[model samples]
Each structure stands twice: as structure tokens, then as C-alpha cells.
Target: MQIPTAAASGRSRLLTSGVALAALSLLLTLHAVPSAADDDTPARGTASMGSGVLAHEGVHGQPAATDRTTQTEGVDVSSHQGEVAWSTLWNSGVKWAYVKATEGTYYRNPYHAQQYNGAYDVGMIRGAYHFATPDTAGGAAQADYFVDRGGAWSKDGRTLPGVLDIEYNPYGDTCYGMTHSQMVGWIRDFLDRYKARTGRNAVIYTSTNWWQQCTGDYSGFASTTPLWIARYASTVGPLPAGWTFHTMWQYTSTGPVVGDHDKFNGALDRVKALAEG
Candidate 1:
């Protein structure tokens, strides 16, 4: 995989430094993101959805807006969800699942096969995701590692594209110690490599706050990649700079199943189209 060496050569140094310092300071003040290895269940109904104004209609345990927009409800899980009963989840009206496949450059989910395959076996549209660790390795290298593990996709119409979970670092340095431009370059590298290997862009999972503070509100990825906004509120909060709409919304961490509840932004057919890609 090729690494970008001079990603920000054309940008003015003064502007870059100012933005980077401000972003770093802001991230420092933000709370550390919860570790996926630990229970994120309680944070489900907590302020991750933001405080006050609950207006969404609950689907099973998922609460979203009552407005009649067609959506397919689903769930996202890591090993933290533990020994998922896919059939039971499927019977609960879940149409899809995004399973955590890999993290950083080294960790691959040990329960990936059981969770992912079981989801497929139970007739649910399935996808895999990489928990990005931009500080640990070059984006291209990490992307390669991710796809090699479970992030690759098939045009089977039942398999959704891989996802890049780029958000608050559960580790130190919320921005992963990279400037906005640098972070964007690393993400670009990963997306490029993933597309080259799998023939489709990966879905980007992020929160509004993280995108603004860490990525300097970069909007370039909006056009090519699909956004999966994780805002546990009555509505998706202000999205990252470019996205006019979210492709998927993760509404709650505490769901009917052993995972986070999510909704595809459109009808079942649209979700199938995404899977077909």
C-alpha cells in the first residue's frame, strides 16, 4: 500500500498550525470515548444522543422520529455484544447487522465469523467494519489489514460495504495526534485502498463532534463515501460539513439485541442496493 508523504504541501503553514492547535485543545477538553471492550450499554440512552428533547418513535428498543420516512432498522456489534443469537434478533424485525471485524493494525475480532456468518445465515444483510487507529499505522497498511481480516465485501446483494469507524480514540490523543489535513489524508489513503481492493467505498461511521473537532469538519469524503452518523438522539444532529443526509443512523447502544441499534436512511430496497455494491 502506498503512503502519502507530502499530503499538505500546498497549505499555508500558519493556518494549518492554528487550526491544529485549536482542534487538539478542543479534543483534550472532550471526554474520552468509551472503550468497546467495556460495556457501552449504559451509554445507550445516555447523552451520546445529546441531552433533552426525545422526539423519535421507538422501533423495538430503537427510538427515532415519527415522521414517515422509510427506514430499515438494524444493529452493530463487537465481541462486547457477546455470543449473539442472530435468529432471535432477526425475529425482532432487524434487517441488517454491522459486525466489528478488525481494529487498528493488529486486533481482529475473534468472534467475527460466528457473529457475521450467523447474521447471514439468519437472512440478515450483513457488513463488517474496522475500528480505525490512525495513530498506530499508515492508513493504507491498516486498511489492508482490515480487509484481509474481514472488511472485504462481495456484490452478493446481502453484504454491505465495509465501514471505517473513525471517531473519538478510546486511547490517548482523541485526534490520534494528527492535524486535520493529516487525518483527512490518512482517511483518504484508507478509503482508496479499501475501494481498490473491494471495488466499493467503505461506509464512514463518525459522530458530529468528532468530525468537526478532529477532521476540521472536512467534507471531501461526503460525495464518494456513505456516512453512518452515530447520534443517539431524537434526530441526527448537525452532520459533518459536506453530508446533506446520512446513509445510516445509529440511534441507541442499548437495543433489543446484544448490540447498538441502527437504521438505514432509506427503504429496504435501497439497503439492498447498497449491499449489491
Candidate 2:
């Protein structure tokens, strides 16, 4: 499926971006990403496909995996649709889920409400929402939009901090595509507003390219405002300089989620505590 964009590099997709080209290397390195070995996690009653792989949503669980899971890694289960959500994920042992609450300019995730309700129903804590912010949308407005669609920061049992989906599209064929500083600014703006409204630090979800080429100072940000790195790999080569700890990892693309289809997700361990706080 086609994911939305946050950068303005003039390309319909980021096939040419350094980040995009390196995406495969990154995802393959995710500690829990799927591979050719461990087909699926053995669940009690779920029917398994003859392949010895578990059937979920439309895809089958692969044996070889690094660390993150299709169901537990990314945003809300809403990302996957038309299938058993709560039950499947609950059975699959998902730790947390980030729901795509909103998108650029004017799009809120169609499944935001239902997915939120589903997570609530299953009692999966450590929830977060991603905003497809535009490079040209400016900081303050985008930040406000994030909260506007990010659901209740304090109301819905406390969220695990907000995330900024910074990739391509928003800036769209801009002069130099999207620079590192731009993404940093985007995160800074979003976090500032969120903190002002909720009185808490926000998390930053970025790829290695953005962090390496753009970021230099994460020290100013709170330690608790953990980084959610999106690399789909078995090993992260080496932690990029300057960063300390990450909260989530979008380790793979070969994922199987029940319903619409759970694309792009990661591992979330501290999700519960962060959301509760």
C-alpha cells in the first residue's frame, strides 16, 4: 500500500532519497523484523496455514524475524482493516500500537475512532498517533493539527507521547527536497505545542537519514522523550551518534496484520509505562 509523505522532494516516491535507498538495509537490521526462519508466533487456538505460518489479516507470518512485529510495532490496529483486530493482536502478543490519527493539510485517519475504540476494548496501552506534516505547513499550525487529531493527550488514559511522521510529500519538489534542519524544526514545533497543551515532552519518530544528515543536538530534549527509530532491519549497524535510547522500532515491511493490512511497524517495550504516565 502507498503510505503518505511528509517531505517535498519533488518525487512521487522517495526511491532516490538516500534515506529511501537505505531503507531496506535499515529494516533488515531491526532486531525483531521478520525473516526466513521463525515463521510465526505460536498462538493457542488460531488456525495456522498449511505453510506452518500463521494467517493474519491477508499476509502470513514468516519464521525468520528480528524483533518488531507487524501487529505491535506501528500505529493503531486501524492501519489494518476488514479483519479481526483486537482478538488477533491480543493473541499475537502486541505490546503497543500507534494509531495514525491525522495526515497533512486536511486528512484524519478514517479508522482513528474505531481503532482507538478497539485498542480501548482490548486494553492495549501505550498508544500514540502520527501526523503527516508538510515541510511547507510551518511549525505552529502543524503542531496544533497534531494535537487536534492526536486524540486526548491526557484524557484517553494518557498517550505514550506524540510522533511526527517526517518523510516526503509535504514539501513536494521544493528547492532542495527536505533538509535535516527542516525535520528537526518540524519535531521542535510539534513538541513545543504538545508540551504547552499537555505539559509533557513529545517523542520524535525519524529515519536514520533524517537523524544522521540533519540532527546534531538531542541533548536539549528530555531523556524521557525517547526516540522512535524507523529502520526495517535485523541489526541497526550502530546507534547513530547523539541518541541515547529509542522507544519503538519500525523494523520490517514484510508484516502480517489482521484486517485492512498493517504496514510498517516496530517494537514498543516502554509503551505501556509511557502512555500511562
Candidate 3:
């Protein structure tokens, strides 16, 4: 299948106004992973916008405006294991999943493996892999680790948009001891490599602090990537400044799923739209 045209590959979701593109929508296969509102969140992307239109408004050779990601039902896994049943999770009800594939320099994720593959085997179409990035290693390394070990993706090396887990991990040493700039540099380098190998831009998964502390500057690639923001609170609100919009929002963190004992996830309506439209 030819990749849809999104101008310049991946762009910052902030530019999209964080709303679903009502005009054009499509279905994808994604997995459930862990996500949080912090700095170390990783980000990466890769996809040829067949028409470069986000909401049919920006399809003019320009990337589509995710101002709306069609309202998807998603879940993050790395946080809990043995709770969600792999075989029944998707059937119980889940549209897309952001499964954690890698973290820091090592760590392939013990739970993500089964959960990610399970989502696909069960039939969840909207799928993607997430990386837990640290401000120390940068994005490039994270990208490499993910692409190399994330999972059995298109050998053509492509996914709707690969994820960068950009969240601060105080307990982990993956960040090494690099300065803030050094960390962001690594992320940029990773995004670059990911695009070169996969032929698309990478998405950045970050929170308010991570965006300010590690993801600052580097807007040069904003138009080439998307931002998956994790801002959890009492209720869903607008995205942070600079970011036009978020590709996926982790609104709620706890829920019920047949696969997992007690699961946490987001709404599924949008994801269904992404599949239907």
C-alpha cells in the first residue's frame, strides 16, 4: 500500500491544533504501551502523506492537520503486566495500542512483547510502538533501538508513525548524565536516522515538562513529525503551547479490560473513525 501523502514526512502535532482531521481518515494497527506526562518522552515518525492532507484542509501537498485524530480508543502497557489478557484485550474492546517496545539503551520490554503482538493477533488494526526515552541518550539512539528491536514491523521499514517515548525517568540511568541539549540532540539524531531507514518521520511522546526541558527548540523538524502528548488530569484540556495538537491523548489511566485485570486507556471512538474514515 502506498503511504498517504503528508507534507515533509512527519510534523509536530502541535501544528495540527490537536483535533481530528474530519476530512480524511484511515485505519492502522497499533499496540498498547505505557505513557506518562514527563520530559524523557521519545518521539519519531515515518510516512509519505499520499496527498499531504491532514484534515483535507492541509492535504495540499502539506501534511494533514491532526487537529483531530478521529477520536481513538487507546491503551499503554509497560505500566502493568499480567493484568490485561493478551488474547482477550482486543476482543474485549480496544481500537489502537501504543506498546512499549524499548527503553534506554537496553531493555526490550518484558510485557510489551506479548501485549504488542497480541493486539495484532487479536485484530486491533490501529497500532504503533512506543519507546521510553531519557533526556540523557537523545532521540537518535532511542529510534535505532526501537527500529532494530521494536517488533516485526514492515520490513520496508514503515508504520503509520513510529513513537518516541519522551518522559523523564528519574529512577533509570538510560539518560546517562548528558546535559539537556545533549539529550535533545540525541533525539534529533534518532529522528533523522529513523526517517532515513523507515522513509517517514517519527512521533514524539512527551509531557509538559519533557517538552520544556528536553524537547525545546528543534522545531526545524516539527513539520516533519507528530507529537503524542500525555497530559493526564481530572479532565481533558487543550494541548500545551507550541504544540499545535497531539496525535494521541492519554486522558484517563485506569479502566477495565477482559484481557488485563484492571486496565487503563483512552476512548475508542476516534480510533474507530481512523479505521472507518
- Winner by TM-score: 1
lDDT per residue (tens digit) for residues 1-277 in model 2: 8565666444645557767768877776775656645654422212111111112112433322554443244333333342336757766765455666665546566666777667667766635455444444665676677677754477455356666654323223321255656656666776777788777677665555544554543345545466665554463334445666555555444446543122223334345456656
Cα TM-score per model: 0.78, 0.62, 0.59
Q: Residues 194-228, candidate 1, lDDT per residue (tens digit)?
A: 99999999999988888888899999999999999
The TM-score of candidate 2 is 0.62
How many clashes in candidate 2? 45
Error (Å) of candidate 1 at residue 244 is 0.8
For each candidate, the alpha-carbon lDDT, in order, equals 0.82, 0.51, 0.50
- How big is the positional error of residue 101 in model 3, measured in Å on the Cα after superposition? 1.2
**Model 2 alpha-carbon drift over 4 Å, by segment:** 1-84, 155-158, 169-182, 214-224, 258-269
Whole-model lDDT, model 1: 0.82
Question: Alpha carbon lDDT of residue 96, candidate 2?
Answer: 57
lDDT of 3 by residue, 97-204 (tens): 666666656666666556666766666653455455454355666667778876324532112356665555434442335575676677678778788767666666
Q: Identify the leading candidate in terms of lDDT.
A: 1
